[model samples]
Target: MNNLINIFFLFLTLTTSGFSQKPTGVWDAFAFGAKGDGKTMDTKTIQTAIDQCHAAGGGKVYLHNGTFLSGTIYLKSNVTLYLEAGATLLGSANVADYPITPSKYPTYGGDLVTDKMFIYAEEAHNISIAGRGTIDGRGDDFNGPYLSPSFSGRPRILHFRNCENVQVRDVTLRNSGSWVQFYQSCRNMVIDGITVDSRENKDIEKSRHADAKGRNTDGMDLVDCQVVRVSNCFITSGDDGICLKSLSPNESCRDITITNCIVSTNASGIKIGTETSGAFEDITVQNCTVFDTRVDAISIMTVDGARIERINISNISVRNVKGTAIFLRLGARNRTYRKNAKAATGILKDILIENVQGTRIGGYGCSITGIPGFLVENITLKQIRLRFDGSNKPLLSDDDTRKPVPIAPPAVNHTVPEKIDAYPRGEMFGRLPAYGFYIRHGKNISLDNIALDYADDENRSAIVADDVDTLEIIGLKAKPSPNVSEVVQLKNVRNSPNLPKSN
Candidate 1:
């Protein structure tokens, strides 16, 4: 040990010359007395190396050739932790190993998340984590219940709060107790070439019953951030795969682009807000693939008085979407996120989704709905093809097969509800009256070159538009059910183009 210490100082001296003016060099964890034996606690030594690197005006803290069990790595400014291929940074299972990281940013329910975090950086700039190593949060061993923003005993794998110029690339991140990574109120971030897998099983219902350890392992969350890029990634999780949330009325999630990625999850694959207190603008998502998702493959919502606008999603492929292909909702769920926070109905508008294809979707159809006065506006879907699993029309009595179709005018009006404050879901209105698309309370919606089909025998209209304005459909090709009298039903719709022509 004495010789090792002498060699370390000698190497430092040789690298730095007479003065300790090393601008950039690799700071090895082993030099700081870290035993990467997987059983020992190397957190302090690794943190010390990071501190030294930061103090020396920035360098890389190298961790290689071992498995390091650690907790709560606090990354600082201009510092980067480069993990080599043979190294692994494992999260400690003990709950007390993580500290409580406080924040002033209002989010989800405005309650503090039960965390510090496994890898935490707060108010730091020009920070990064790049490598080929694996970071395992070991979420399977964590015991807790997910009850919102205040649930205890679960910690996020990575949390970068109020930061700038953050880059996370080429790492395998998985098994978080809650959301795998949370980037809140950050700017100018790039997350590229990363792989994340946190699913407990292929089937969520069976997995929840089989393993009752942890909950809510979403893949990645970008909250109220701007100017971000995410590309060349693959993610699959127990919850939403990639999420954009806006939880503060003062800040909006804007200027984001996500491309060339693949995601699968038990929840929605790509989503924007269950937390819509702010705006989502200038976002583009293209060249992505989503599969094996239990909810809508793509879902966008504005429920808490925020504007969702100027968003584009193109060239997306989906398979085995258990709920629907797409869901857009503008609701008046004017619930407060925090104390003294007011709520109001928001606007959802100016969205374009084109060149999307999907198969093996459920009976919920593609729903785009708004409340009475707040209409979803200026949405367009072009060159989209989707197939839904057929459904039998619900009957008043199953014993009599000759019952009249329950999806008539009076029944259709009552089939959809105005659940203003409820969380948005494609199936929230239950089985829709349409088999292909259910559009209500919408304005200036144009569906062009849409091809829809069903796997089994369906008994509903191909499209149903209620309270829709300026509705237009071109080259509308669909397989209408034999029992349905009309292929498309329009109620209280005004300013629409000619009735759709079947291709």
Candidate 2:
């Protein structure tokens, strides 16, 4: 009888232990706040419950069809925040309640500072926040201070840093105080089927400011991250739509891709490097649409000495660009980098733009600027058609609005007036074009099919290759009207032996 009793007790113990080891759903079990009728304002209790769930074992924490007010939620690995349809996670308004820590600011620069976010995770892995629920950051609460004349605003709505294998999908993140979403130094990250909207304010000018304006409120910012992909997302805000950034002037950003996305408003559509302290390479942006932007539709710049190279932008359609359709500038300025106790600067190279189409370019069709020898090179513009409807060329600066007018070739011989000459002088019509096709100063380049159209009835160049080498034009076409000829013309003087013609 004693042996039998002991056996029965052993069996019970084993069964209970196995049952405890199984994954428990947070709501079904009282790990955080009591699964409260799923109605009460159980903020602290719910947070406590979530912490307990993480400590015990990773599992699913849920908010099902109710309004839940919360302050900073920390998520751990092997855990997921699943929200049922119509559920809302409202953020706390008091700034002090959400304390700042060493967090990342997607743009401007990086250093730890105090900030708040709806969902935040750092240095963790294998995590996901998925469902049909809405994560609302009551941006209006945090709006006053941010909009103050002196305020620079906070970072982003949702941020994840130094994490691996992260997934954020099917969530509506709206009215963020700053950028809608930001991912910094994260790897293997995927963001899909996300919808963000912040256009309620009608003050178009103030809404576009980098500070009180949308400021750094980009739709999605991927910073110094690898193996990152953003797809099927719609973003419209007061700032850039989809942006990729790196520590300017030094580090390299690789293996990043953006596809099948719609980005509009405020500023550039898809941008890389205004703060480029780092190098950007192996980047591909394809099948996207951008319009109604105040600045360049697609702009790549490194003024503070960032070495950018190996970028591939293809199958992009842009319209109504208030600035240049494509603007690439390598500033003749110095970037400050620390050595022993001082800072220094350098140059940039290796960029490409291909398969791009634009309509109604308010500025120039394209713009490229840099210095001598250490210039921007190996850039290509292929299969591109641009129609500039405006009469005035987009100004590079307030005083420099005179559009670059290409010199025409002799009418009788159909040859460029000047022979292939040396630096600065031969490029009197413009700067020495390096390896360009239907354009100028872009070097060692090729054009499969490129068209440049002007509505101002002024002359425009079909192809401008100033100071370049090894250029090939397979199918080149241009129409510089008689009236427009004084302002623009087409001439290929690179003297390459193999210039192919499709017609």
Candidate 3:
């Protein structure tokens, strides 16, 4: 009996290896369960086909014009999931079918298992999932009972981790569980001409448990990644339309460009995290149209102990904002990670906002706040027109919400670097601001060609700089608003450049 068992095991191994090594294309091998005896589940056959293709050589796993019900199909290196124009790859509703495996799982807060994504691809190169058809996760199947009780369950539609040279275009990804699309630790990713739809409304609040709300999905989230360009996409989700986050203080997420997109989010139109810990620089978000968001239309925040710097925002427009039009927050609670809890917190600086217009802003026109020991500097606002709704006028507070008092700059830390001693040189774009731009305990800050339009007369100043140094402002203007007084100031200023004309 023992000998027989051993022989059977050996034969099974050989057969499995042989099948796994077979290379089959569309014509040679086909798994058509849609017509094969209604009970014929083609999952095993399709897996065998993909395994064979990978074992021999990577090629396309083609699906014809039929409904192919599949469980999380893992694509190997050099393999592609190609669908015909009329094909639809339907996902299995049984949650048990997708066994918990090591996929591209990006952890947040203290829990690593709270949010698990499907369709995960990790550590692969030159892998593509392209088609004219659809790769629907059927996210609604996992919506109730076993889902999050407070809000709703999250299901990630397509998640790619640590991948390279990935291109996703001409696809319709609807009914996602959590984030519609998420790419982490990836490089050279291009996402164009895609549509993301959700059933959740934007009236929900944003917090740690925002995912529990219905369709509380982030359209696209790129964290700690590089060389990602997202353009020409329409995203209307229950949460942020398009958000980029890098909260780990040890790493840097740089070199990302977003252009020519239409976004109508429930939260922010284009936002950097309140949990931003790492540095986000060399980012360009331009030529986008946003409408009807509950939060800021375009927001860059560094709460807690995070450091965000060198972000360029240009050529964007927003309509019907239910929150602040544009808010640059450097408050005390932005830090979601404790990596930098020891160091004196950093600043959110070198941000350029140019050619942005909005209608019916629900909150304050704009607010730039800095916590003690950290400053919000080198921020330029050029050509901005913000009109707010007349109802639900919340009292705009001037009381600094930051706890730790802000630091003061060195009185002798003059702008002119003394011959050989320059105060830690840093590269910058555009000219520095002279007067309208404020600074405190911050060195090497500048603003040029920033125009402010205060259409509301019952509000406060347009630009206020309380405690900062080495500040520069040029060409500042405040368009006539109803009851606004003294729209720009350089309060407690020191060792700064000359003020420009406030037209």
TM for every model, in the order presented, reads 0.90, 0.75, 0.74
Could you give candidate 3's per-residue lDDT for residues 1-503 as a string of tens digits?
Answer: 99999999987896666443333543112542233222345566566656666766777767765676766566566767676677766666766555555333435442333234446677777767677767666677766432232124445777776789888876777776667787777899888888777546433333322344355577888877788888888888766788887646765568999999988876677888644666677889999998866656788866545567779888888887655666666655433544224422656888888888777664333545455556677776667655544222432221111121111211111231111111110101001121112233444455566555423333334455656666676665555334444656566666764863322
lDDT of 1: 0.82
Sort the candidates on TM-score, descending order: 1, 2, 3
Stretches off by above 4 angstroms in model 2 are 1-22, 25-31, 34-43, 102-110, 143-155, 200-213, 248-251, 332-350, 392-442, 456-466, 469-474, 486-503
lDDT of 1 by residue, 35-111 (tens): 98999999998998888888778878889999999988899998888889879998899888987666655446675
Which whole-number lDDT from 0 to 100 does residue 242 have in model 1? Answer: 97
Q: Would you list the C-alpha lDDT of every candidate in the order shown?
A: 0.82, 0.59, 0.60
Q: Where does model 1 exceed 4 Å of error?
A: 1-24, 104-114, 149-151, 204-214, 392-414, 500-503
Off by over 4 Å in 3: 1-46, 103-106, 109-115, 144-153, 202-212, 304-306, 334-344, 390-459, 468-484, 493-503
TM-score of 2: 0.75
- TM-score-best of 2 and 3: 2
lDDT of 2: 0.59
Candidate 2: residue 274 lDDT (0-100): 60
Local accuracy of candidate 2 as per-residue lDDT tens digits, 1-503: 99999999987885564233334455322334433344454566556545555666666677775777766676677667776678777766655545566654332333354366657788878777778888776665565433221123343568777789888888877766677777777899888887776543324333234244333456777877888888888877666678776653445567988888887756567888565556677888889888766556787766555667788888999887655577666653443332321112424456667788888765333555444444556767778888765333322221112233342322111232332121111122231221122243446656667776766533344444444455666666555645433222334335556753211
